[model samples]
Target chain A: MLALAWANLTHHKLRTTLSALAVGLGLALFLVSNGLATGSIGEVADRMESVQAELLVLPAQENMVFSGGAVFTPGWTDHLASVADEQGPLATDVIPAYWSQITMGGQQQRLFGIDPEQMPLFLGDRGMVAGHAFEQATAFSQRIRELRATADGQPLDTLLDDDEWSAGLELVIDDRLRRVGQDGHPYEIGDVVRVLGREFRIVGVVESGVAGRVFAPIETLRLINDGGRQRSTMFFIKLRPGLDHLVAARLFTEQLGSTVQVQPTSDYGRRLQQELGKVFMYVNVTNTLALIVCFLFILLTMYTFVLERTREIGILKSLGVTRRGLIGLSMLEALLISSAGAVIGIALSFVAQAIIAMRLPLLTVELPPQHLATAVAIGLVGGIGSALYPGWRAARLEPAVALGYE
Target chain B: MISVRNVQHNYRHNGVVESVLHGVNLAVAEGEFVVLMGPSGCGKTTLLNILGLMMSPTSADSVALAGTETLGLSDSARTRLRRETLGFVFQRFNLLPTMSVRSNVALPLRIRGQHADGAVDKMLDRVGLLPQAGKKPGRLSIGQQQRVALARALIGRPAVLFADEPTGNLDSASAGAVLSLLREFHRDWGQTILLITHNEHLVGAGDRVLTMRDGRLHD
Candidate 1:
């Protein structure tokens, strides 16, 4: 029976190949869609957790992953530090940070601004991959003072040359940015990237997922925001060892009142996942549709195949092949075809992943083992489910009538 | 061994009743070779079909194969009887084209859920097709294909063999070869045979001959 089923498929090479390809295409679509959904969300969550913070003091009513402009006054940094000290030493460190998006290499890149002195605590072991961290705080202060002295109550750009102003500022960028632009060239150390109408030299390249793609001194970001506005976006707090983040978050909420929302840093990933629930919903719908398309493809293919083999089926019945045996033969053919399709789908998924990586470097496509297993399962279920009716039809065929079928 | 009495068959097409067999009766003892002869559309094949358990007569007083009553049996039970007691060689060979000759010859036993245990190879060797067993049926000549079909039918050592114009599609020489092989099997194994043919010359090969015309039979 197995030999017969396999021989039938191989004898009709074009038809069998087309059926397998159709099923493979459907499975591939499902795998890529599912990969993108989980990949993007997982990347965001993992990046958030990589910051190594215990709690976050977000601007009131702001729960999104990305928001533009400064939302908290710079004075909140001092106030939060003072409050944490008074609240039974609730936190060991309180770091106010600013973030904004900037366009570079025709892509929107996240830029985080942190105090030069506090970066070591936030970065942990995922330190610079090239060059060095931001200069000592005193050196940055000295540069700011020199800029003020040269400005003499006028715009710094007007007072100094582009090279002179850019030479004094430094930017620590993510390693991924090293290979930017359509040319696929790397941005080496000392290379300048223009942002906010001022060029800043790249001082270091850091591993990705350390808060943002690019990091700069908070003073430099403050200078760029609305012509040196005195405001920050959020605060990252590290609690004292053995302190419960939830309890500390509650205490901070009370101290700051309703002006700020405090939450454990661990919740950031879960929050982002919830925020993108609609993406996951769309993936699920597409996955279902893909499998349905596969089912329909197999159903149509097997029906036509059975119709063409009516006389052969009669011959088997005449040879004493039971109805159940006929059904088994049909199902076995379906299984072989579906197994072929699954292999093709997995191969196509990897090709799709490569293309995505080449075309959209910023996007992450994760082909987890679970998703691969699901794709294979979809193929088997779709193939077998769709074969049921056709198998039954073949088994139910009257031997004499089928032998006479034209 | 086969027995039948008062067996009738009718077919309806497009709301019109077409009676194909009327009051047919047949009895062939074990090891007896019987030839059923009739012109096309004269119901020889229909009667053979009824005796082979491939069709149920519209009405039958009694029908038995190997002493087992066949009428009133379920379709599955009839299929089992066909598998265990009867073999058939159709005019067109009816070989599954996709399978190699060995696989085709091995089919009956496979359907019975029995391992060939070298029976397939031994049968092929007996039919002078052992060397061609690896080839697909389509690659064989008409005579070779007929021999393959014969090997398949006899593989299970069935009690009765039904040959419906088994040599119809073969040349005279190929037909002679097939007939010789059938005679050889009957002579050595005493295999009861019910062969249907329109050719008068082939009638001499059977122990007895029966003729059919207009839905009735005459011995």
Candidate 2:
């Protein structure tokens, strides 16, 4: 029986190969699409949790970690700092930051305005890979103050020389951004990157997966974006070593009223998934449809194959091969094809991952084991399931009638 | 051994009943070689099908094969009976073209959950096809393919061998060769043979000959 099934498949090589490839392509699409969705969300959550802060304070409506805009004031940070001084154990440090979408080197990306002096403390043990961490940011802030005092409120870019402007707004980018520079080249230290409509030289490259891809000094950004009103969109807070962040978050929420949202950084991944539940649902629905299409394709292919072998089936039946035996043979063929398709799908997923990594460096693509298992299961089960009707039809065929079939 | 008494069969198509076999009665003892001679559409194949347990007659008093009453047996039971007691050769030589000659001959043993145990090679040697065992049925000549089919049918050592115009598509020499093999198997193993044919010249090879016409049989 096994020999006969194998022979039948090999007898029509092109059809079998095409059928398997169709199934393989469907599984690969499901895997890679789901991988991208989960991978992008996971990447953002991981980077947010790596910011060295136990908690973040944002405007009440802002639950997503990467949403960038000037939504509140730096006065909130001063208030948090005041509380840290008073409570002693409830809080230790508060760092103000501004986040916004800005174009750099003709690509839109997230930019975080972090305090030059406190950025290192907030990033505890996360060292830079190239140059220094905002070494001239303090001096640049002082220069901005002096220029504001003397220039009668002239635009900052006009008041300074090109080199002075570059020095005043130094940029620090993550290593991922460095891989994709203007004109298909990689960025390096001392290269000027245009951000927020101003040229700022890249001073340092930090390890990826911490905060936004691009960063600048808070003082300069606040003065430019907030008109020196000392506004900040969020504040990162460090806690005493043994404190429960959930309790701290509840306390912050109680004190800040309905205008602020506080959450522990560690819970960001789960929270982000909840916040983007609809996106994930859409992805799952789309992938399931792809699986169904693959199932239907196998069904049609196997059905046609069985039809073509009517006379052969009749011969087997006449030779006393039971209906059960015939059905088993058909299902066995389906299993073999599906198993081959699953292997092809897995290989194709890796190829897809590599392509995505090369073309879009910042977009992480994860091939989790469970997704692979699910894809293979779908292929196998679907193949068997799709063969059921065709096999049954073949089994139910009358030997005399089938033998007479042209 | 085969027996039939008052067996009848009909096929209905588009509200019209076409009777193919009517009250057919026949008996062939164990080891007897019987030839059923008939014109086309004269119910010879239908009677063979009923005797082979491949079809259930619309009406029958008794239709027994190998001492078992087969008229009302379940499909699986009939299938087991067919596998255990009978073999068939068809006019088209109905060899599975996808399989090599040896594999085709080994099919019955495989279906019966028995290993070939050199039976396939032995049968191929008997059929003078040992050199062609590895070749697919499609690559063989018509006569060779029929010979392979004959080997497949006889390899299981069935009690009854049913040949439905086994040499219908063969040349005279090929037909003579297949008929000789059938005679040899019957003489050596005492295999009960029911061969159907329209060729009157082959009637001499059978121990008894029955003619069927218009769904009725005559001795």
Candidate 3:
């Protein structure tokens, strides 16, 4: 029966191809939208993990901690430090850092400020890939030493060295800094980058694994914020081994008494994800409606195909073909149409994703195994459900009347 | 052998039930060549439909084929009987247009779930359409398509063959050729054949002639 159905479908090649194309377009939209929705959620989780912070501290009144940008008095850091120092059973180290977006070299980069001296304790064996750690005693020693060894000694390497005498600002750009400037080498360590009419020397280049980011000294970041020195935007704390992040977060909230929002790393990330998910819910809804509409279209078209072939069905019936056999044949036809559509749609989606990735590097569209499985399941369900009414009509047709039809 | 007893049929049009076959009874023995002759509205086609098992009377005790009773059979069982014991060639040459000539010829075999190996070629050859087997029915002449339909019907080796004006759509030459082939097959194989036609001139070749008028068969 399936073999007969297949032959019939192929017999009308043009109509079959057109019908398959219609189904394919609908399935493509469904698959592409689902991939993007899942990808956005995954991207948020990935960004949170990259921060490597066990706990996050933000202003208490902040409803959306990830997006609203934490704003609190710099004195809050001192309070958190004192609380950690005096703790007996649940003592932990708290590191305070400030973060904000800044425009430099005509591109937006996230700026991070950390106290050089205390950073190693938090980083702990995680050293920089490029420059050495900041040394306070000989803070200006390496620059002066390298400058004196140059042939001219005329302060020609002034931007690379001499951060104290030239300006207190220092820029730590990411590996993507390679894209800027004529030489395609946008101001390496000790070179100057002008931001908002202020020139800052690139004291170091920090290669954070995630792309499109930059970091600077705490003092330099304060300068970039127009002398807002005492305030910090975020406080990151690392817990001791075997110490639960939730326990540490609870201690902070208890000590602060709602003066700030204290949340574990995972919880904060999840909250951020939830906020992002709200924006994509509309997309999911629209795509779902589109898929439903597509299912209906497939049903209608396949039903019409069956109707148009009524005489043929009648002939088969008069020839001793059982009702179940006829139904099976129609279902096989439906399945062939659906499976063909799914394969074309999924293949086109992969191609589209690849093309978009080339244009937008950050857009990662991956069709996982579960996604493929879902598409196939949708096809099967669509095939069976769409064929039911048509198959029934064909099965119920009386051969005598049909044979007499013109 | 085939027997029909007191069979009646009617058509309803806009609340009017017009009787077409009124308690008609007829019989044809094995190896008989019977021709039914009638005017357009004389129920010739309706009688042929009943004889082919394509329809059943509204009220009747039995329409028997060989030794088995057909009136008590279920719809599917009747269909099986028709498939195994009957073959039909229609006036319009109702071949599936989407199918090739070979496929159309092999349709009955396929429907019976029989192995179609060499069956298509043999049937097409028997109909003298071997070279045109790959063409669709729509591409063929009315006579050629009629031959394909004949091949499809005869492929199952049915016990009784029912033809309703089988050459009505053909040219005179094609029509004569088809009629000659039918007569030859009937004579050579000793197969029972019932032919319905309004053209009384063709009745001379049949072994028996039954004329129908006003919903009754005349001896």
Candidate 4:
């Protein structure tokens, strides 16, 4: 039976080819649309994972830290620390961080200032790629502190206690600025740089694995920003192990009052993902409309084939072919056309993804196995469904009358 | 064997009734070569259609095949019986132009769920056209194409063969060749053949002949 159906299809090569092409075009559109949507969401998740923050504390109503323009008051960090001390084991440590724009190498770069001692606690031991982290015993509260007692006549402690000792002063910059430095090399360790009229030694360079960003010690940032009396833009917090993030978030929000917002880090990532998902959904809907239009075009093409073959149908009926057989033959023809189209469409999707990825490095279209299977199934159903009415008309034809006509 | 009693059919044009066949009755026995002779619009093809189970009578008293009444048979059943027990040849040869002569000859067997490769070879060979089986009907002479259609009709080894002006479109030489092949099949296989024609000269070849005028069969 399949052989017969195939033979019949090959008998009219032009018609069969046209019908298959229509179905193939529809399948290709569906695959490319879904790949783009999936790729967009995946890119967002990847970017968030690279940031490596356990929790992001922000205002409750803010949607995005960068775009929402959220600001934390100067006293907010002190108030959060007090609340953490009162809370049980669920509260770990909170680090104050700020994001600001600064002119560097004739380009505005985003600067991140973090507490040097607490940074390693959250970012792990691989802190600075080029220089060492700040020494823990260094005096943080006063301008100068006495070093280990020396065996000199005046005693080394008195000399080290003077404010002139500045060897430990350090700053960190990102790799991007290193490429665009005035001397063809960005600041390295022991290199003094001026920022906001304050001189600081470049003790290290850090690679955040993100583009367009720089990092500096909190004390040095305070000096550059003319003291840390003003608020910061972002904060990173860590919770005690095995604590329910939602419950901890609720407790923190209640304690901090309405002036600040507390959110679990994962939840923030999910919200960003959802925003990206909406954009993808819009594209999906547009593709669905295009698919419907393609289906209609296929219907028109198949209908024309049926109309042209009315006499053949009549002859088959007169030869005592069953109506079911006729319908089966038509469906088989549709299935073959659709299957061929689906395969071609899937191949075309890969090609399209490659082309798009070349132009947009961040956009990587991936065709999962599920997406391929779904595209083929949709093509088959669409082909068979569109062919139903015409097949019925052919099946119900009266052989005697049809044979009588031209 | 086939029998019909008081079968009537009509055509409706804008709600007006125009009867084509009225009170038509006839029978043809197994292995009997019968001919239905009539002029144009004499309802010969209509009766043949009723007997072939291709169309149903509007006011049928009784139409039976091999002792079974056909009125209760569903459309699909009728179609199956036609595929299994009957074969038809038409005036125009009616060969599928896209298919080779062998495939055209094997169509009825193919429709009956039989493998056509061997049957097609044997049938075409019997018609002395095995050498030309690869050619399409359009490439064959009218006589050869008619023989191909006949081969198709007889490939299933049906109980009866119905030929409606089977040689009508051929020249005299081609028509003679087709008639000779039909007679050879009838004599060799003892097949029951019912042929319809407007030409009266061919009636003598049949074992029995029935004439129709004004939609009723006569002696």
Candidate 5:
């Protein structure tokens, strides 16, 4: 019976191939779109968790974490350091950081301004991929603060009594920026980048996707905000290695009062992932529609095939083939076609991943074996289910009328 | 053996009733070779259809096959009876075009849940189609296709073989060859055959010949 079904399908080569192609196309679209959705969301979650700090000092206002993130003053960095745990300090180290969007060479890039002395504490030696780390001098930071407080840039000479203070404006760019400045102009370690009318030379380029693509001194970011602003967006609290962040988060929230928000790192990752999930609803809808279109394509193809084979069905009936046998043959035919199509779709998905890598570099797609199995299973169910009606029609053919059909 | 009495069939077209067969009676003894001949629009094909159980009569006084009453059998019962007792060769040969010649011959046995067990090869060999067993019916000539149909009909060793103008679409040489093969089978196997044709030259090959007209058979 299976042999007969196969022969019949192969006999009508063009029709069978067209139907299989329709099924393959549907499965391929379904796989590629879903993979893209999951991959893009996973990338965002990865980048967010890459931050060095395990504790965030957000604003006390609830839901403000996603509203351009919660902002607080750089003064909070001092308070966090002043607190104590059973160990020497409540937190191992503290960094006052500000994230601001700045256009470099006509493209927006994330600029993280951290205290230069603690760049190793945040990013370690990997942060200094090229050139050298910032020189460890307390006066260099104090000089930038004094210069930023004054209304005019001329106060910088008076504030910086030491000639070496001029070197404090050095920048360490992320490797992502070193490549092409996040799809903008390429930059070397010694290149100069101007942000908000101030020039800072790149002293180092860090690995991509680990830290911010652009890094400057905290006082420099404060100056970019406006003279005498003196405020930072948030305070980053780095916990001791192997220390529980949850315990430190609770300690900080209790000691800092309810006016400040302290959140563990894991919760932030979850919340951001939830945001990405909300954005993926549209892709899910498209995947559903694509599968439906695939189902309809197969259904129409099988129906027309049965119509064309009506006379053959009648002949089989006259040859003493039972209705169940006839129906079984049709279903077997459809299943074989569907199974072959799903395999092709699986192969196509691999090509889709490569295409995504080559064309949409920012988006990553992971086509796990389980995902491929799911696509194949759906194709089987869709293709076989679509043929049931046609099988019934073929089985129900009247031998008397059909034998007479031209 | 086959028997039918007062069997009538009707067709309703455009709200008008047309009687195609009226109270037709037929009986062919076991192993008897019978030929039925008639002009177009006669009830010869209808009678053959009833004997083969491919069509149910609107009403029948009595219908029995192999001494068993088959008149009121259910549809599945009728299909099983056809599978068990009857084999047919139609005007167009009716071979599945996509199937190999041997597969076509083995189909009925497969449907009966019985392994063909070399019966297909034996029948094909008898029909001189052994070399072409693996070829599809479409690859064969019309006469070759009809012989494959003939081999397929007799492969199950059915009790009765019904040939309804089996060579109607063939050239004269092929028709004569088919009739000769039919004669050889009857002579060697004492196989019962009911052949229907409008060709008078084919009538003499049967042990008994009859003509049908106006919904009735004449001796």
Candidate 6:
């Protein structure tokens, strides 16, 4: 029976090839679309996880990590420490951070302003890829207390300020800046870049994968972003080692009052992935539509194949072939065609991935085993299902009338 | 043996009643060979269909096959009876053009849940086309194709054979060859053969002859 179905398919080379190609194309598109989406989300998730902070306490109402952040008193960091003393174990330490921007050689760069003293508690000083690690890697308050002695009887904030009462902000350049830079000149350690009339010196260069370009002290960013007002954009709290981070985050969220939103750093990556999924919701839509189209195309293709073999069907029936036998034959033919098409589609997915990578190197396309299996399974289910209508119609064909068909 | 009485068959075309067979009756004894001769549209093929169990009689007063009443048989039962008792060869050879000659010959038995084993080989060998068993029906000459069809029809060793204008599409040489094969089946195996044809020469190939005209049979 299978041999007969195969023979019939091979007998019409052009039609069979075309139908298989159509189904193959549908699967290929689905695979490529899904691969790109999955790969991109995985990358973003990995990056978000690298932050390593247990909780991020954001200002009430707005928490855009990039821009338009809600500005609140930098005094909130001071309040958190006292609260930790009272609430004990709610949060071991809170680091105030700010986002600032700068223009260098007509190109805009993002700056992440973090407390230099508190940064070492979460990330090691070795975050610096080149030049030198942060000189103040120890406890920030201890370093400030030591610097206060050399302040020559001045206050700590005034002493931390650089020449002309402006703090000399230390900047770490991201490697991405060098990659996008023009030839003959590149940013190196000690080179001073002017940000808003303030000459900020680059102390180290870090890999862009881990950190951003133009990192400055939180106080420096507050001074620059708010015209000397010491207001931090957000606070990142690191829970003490071995403590349940979820419990700590929940406790801190309640302490921050109703307006503030406290998000666990662990769940942030997943939330970002979910947001990205919503943005690419059309990929799912396309996948479903492609599956439906695949089914219908196979159905119509198999239906036509049966119609062409109407006289042959009649011949079989006259030979005592049963109705179930005819249906099985038709379904087997469709199964073979669809299976071939599925293989073609999977094979072509790699080609599609390669082409996408070549054309847009930043975009990733992956065809994992589970995803491939899902695609193939859908192709086959849809293939067999689509043939049912036509198979049934063929099965019910009366041998008498069909024999008499011209 | 086959027995059919008052077998009436009709079909609708564009919602109008168009009767093809009207009160036809037929009988052929065991090991007997019969030929039905008729003009085009004389309902000879229709009678062949009813007797072959390809179609049921619309108004059969009584119909029996090998002493069993077939008119009252369920569709599946009638189909089983057809598989167990009958075979067919058509004018166009009606070979499954896609299948090889061996597979084509073995199909009748295969549909009845029997393995080909050596049955296909025996039939092909009997038809003198065992050498071409693996070749498709299209690759053979018309006479060779007719012989393959004959082998397929007889592979199950059916109790009866119905050849409907088996030589209508064949040339003189091919037709003579097919008729000769029919004669051989009847003489050597005592096969009960009912063949339909308009050619008067085919009558000599059968032990009995009948004619169909205006949807009724005549002796």
In terms of DockQ, the best-performing candidate is 1
lDDT by residue for model 6 (B171-190), tens: 89888888888888878888
lDDT of 3 by residue, B1-219 (tens): 999899999988999999998899988998899998888899988887777777777776668887688887887788788878888888877777767788777778877778886977977888899999889888888888888888887888888998989877788888888888888788777789999888866888689999999999998
**Interface RMSD, per-candidate values to 1 decimal:** 0.9, 0.9, 1.8, 1.6, 1.3, 1.1
Give the residue spans of candidate 5 off by over 4 A: A9-13, A60-66, A95-97, A101-146, A149-222, A226-236, A257-263, A267-269, A276-280, A305-307, A402-406, B5-23, B39-51, B55-64, B67-75, B210-219
DockQ of 2: 0.71
Which candidate tops lDDT?
2
Number of the top candidate by TM-score? 2
lDDT of 1 by residue, A1-406 (tens): 7778889999889888987887788788888877887787787777767766798888886756758443887578777876654446776788877787888656887688887777776577786888887644336645655776666677543554554445447888877667564356677887877886677878888876677777887767766663454478888888888888888888888888998988888888788867767867887787677667756766776677667777888898899988888888878887888889889989999999999977776677889999899889878877876677877887787677778777
Comparing 2 with 5 on DockQ, the higher-scoring candidate is 2
For the candidates in turn, chain A alone yields TM-scores of 0.85, 0.87, 0.71, 0.63, 0.77, 0.67
Ranking by lDDT: 2, 1, 5, 6, 4, 3
Indicate the worst ten consecutive residues by lDDT in candidate 5 chain A: A156-165
Report the Cα lDDT for residue A266, model 2: 86
- Positional deviation of residue A121's Cα in model 4 after best superposition, in angstroms: 15
- Looking at model 1 chain B, report the run of 10 residues with the lowest lDDT sum: B48-57
Compute DockQ for each candidate against the true complex. Answer: 0.71, 0.71, 0.46, 0.39, 0.55, 0.57
Give the range of the ten consecutive residues with the poorest summed lDDT in model 1 chain A. A156-165
The residue pairs that clash in candidate 2, if any, are A73-A232, A74-A231, A74-A232
Q: Tell me how far the alpha carbon of residue A402 in candidate 3 is from the true structure, in angstroms, after superposition.
A: 3.2
Over 4 Å off in model 4, which ranges?
A: A65-68, A73-269, A273-307, A358-366, A402-406, B13-16, B39-42, B96-100, B115-117, B134-142, B199-205, B208-219
lDDT of 1 at A346: 93
- Write the residue-wise lDDT of candidate 1 on B185-212 in tens digits: 9998888999999988898999999999
The local distance difference test score of model 1 is 0.82
User: How high is the CA lDDT of each candidate model?
Assistant: 0.82, 0.84, 0.71, 0.72, 0.77, 0.74
Give lDDT tens digits, candidate 4, residues A1-406.
5766677778888878877777777777777777777665555454334444456677666555244666676676666656643446445677677665666655555666666666455344335667755442134313321222233344332344324334324556654355455455545666776554545566666554331245565544544353434466666667777767777777777777876677666665577656667766787787788677767866776677666766777677778889888878777877888787787778788888888855443355768899889888887887787677788887787677656656
Question: RMSD per prediction, one decimal?
Answer: 3.8, 3.4, 7.3, 9.2, 4.8, 6.2
Evaluated at residue A154, the lDDT of candidate 6 is: 50
